[model samples]
Target: MEEKEPAPGGLALIEALVNTLDVESGTDALDTEENRTRFGLTPADTPGARELREALRATLLAHAGHHPATGPRPPELGRLLTAAPLTITIAPDGGATLAPSPTAPGAPALTARVAAAITEALLAGVWHRLKCCEAETCHWAYYDRSPASRGRWCSMSVCGARAKMRTYRARTRPA
Candidate 1:
């Protein structure tokens, strides 16, 4: 029997990390002793680092976010696996970008491993190696830094052939 393609669970974890906690956006202003009482984020309340870690636990478990066009892209992989994979986009000009998996609403409809994986990927983006898919119409992107430029389609038969088939038909079609 043929194996089926895996879900985008990792991607969902990524979106959840960025969107649920607003980790990227609110990094600079999150915690402090003063707000500890109000926000309840302090070493005392968060004793032994367990509470601290747990406090951020909710923020860490998000498995979905938002997409402009589609509204939300489910991180099917994150849902399936322990840690959802995160795909980073590095521009030619040396800019780093993160694309979150689409989310439906409130929070993760699945697991926590997805969020951890996304956080890991975003942190790694600082170095490089990840990238978005080149196809314009298809928003689904991937990470690639192969030496021989062996990277092409997001998979093999999907985006790659879509282009080739379109071009071939256009070339052979009647005027």
Candidate 2:
């Protein structure tokens, strides 16, 4: 629904995954071979990928202080993350980081990558900045760059404006 800078570091991967489905148009990028390839998913991995995507979306919405209004409840993200295999690596500078353990390709690999990304973002204290827009129809994922981290929409010109206008009209409607 809006265009903005990608989230920094591994958060970008999370953001990209959450946005694979354009909710307003019902166009899931994962449905296409090219898009699936972009995320290292095989055709057989699509179902698991979609499940992960929805769970991520729900979590992102919560980050923005919103709840999804429809659709079946997604599996808990924490549960899924806990199942991914991760390993700790010591960098040349002695900095330790969590990384996906080498695994068979496809959904398992993708889940490991996502788990690693979330771990990195959590350590960096920027995990919550990755949010989904408040607009139910356009819950696109975005990085909240606001200094106060109070951003609620993906774009002020789009979802934000629309929401504000709706409020304005409701408040001014004839009694």
Candidate 3:
């Protein structure tokens, strides 16, 4: 198996948020405090944070050519992002960091930080390479390392092969 490349720093935050819901196992890490904490997510009584994370997942999947699966960005997500702004600081040594605005609170703060990183990556023209697996069961987020930026799955051996097999079977099925 090829060693998969990691997502760029900016998109890593989005990848972290998306993987909390394991599609293959049909499990959600955000359902419990322990699991959420494991992912650096706080368990909020409201579903706002999870919804935002799902919206982010949908956005990235769409970028990966899953437009049919993710039609439009939810309105609530648009509102949430607009409400929470991030602050980026540059060090004298030319390093940079993405953080939530000083006034941003808890979950939104984290989300803001993710938003900031995504924005930075987008401006740098590298955000488009970060994509979610096309296989509905996997839905893993991966960085497209292909020279042409055409990768559509986490691994060709796993999700890619499964998709191909499914398509072949469907096409060859007795009619």
User: Which lDDT tens digits does candidate 1 get at residues 1-175?
Assistant: 0122422445433322222222224332224455333332343432322222222232222211212233344333423343323345789999865443344111222223334445555565521222223344432333334564345444447666877888899999999
Candidate 2: clashing pairs of residues: none
Q: Could you tell me the TM-score of candidate 3? A: 0.80
Candidate 3 residues lying further than 4 Å off, grouped into runs, are 1-3, 38-40, 68-77, 88-98
RMSD of each: 17.0, 1.4, 3.4
lDDT (Cα, tens digit) per residue for candidate 2, span 1-175: 5567899998898899989988889998998999999989999999988888889999999999999886678888888877787888899999997878776488878889999888888888999999999998899999999999999999999999999999999999999
Ten-residue stretch with the least lDDT total in model 3: 68-77
The 10-residue segment with the lowest total lDDT in model 2: 97-106
The model with the greater TM-score, 1 or 2, is 2
Off by over 4 Å in 1: 1-111, 126-152, 157-159
Per candidate, the number of residue pairs that clash is 19, 0, 0
For candidate 1, what is the TM-score? 0.29
Candidate 3: how many backbone clashes? 0
Better of 1 and 3 by TM-score: 3
Q: Alpha carbon lDDT of residue 107, candidate 2?
A: 84
The global Cα lDDT (0 to 1) of model 1 is 0.37
Model 3, 8-30: lDDT tens digits are 88687677677777887878777
Clashes of 1: 19
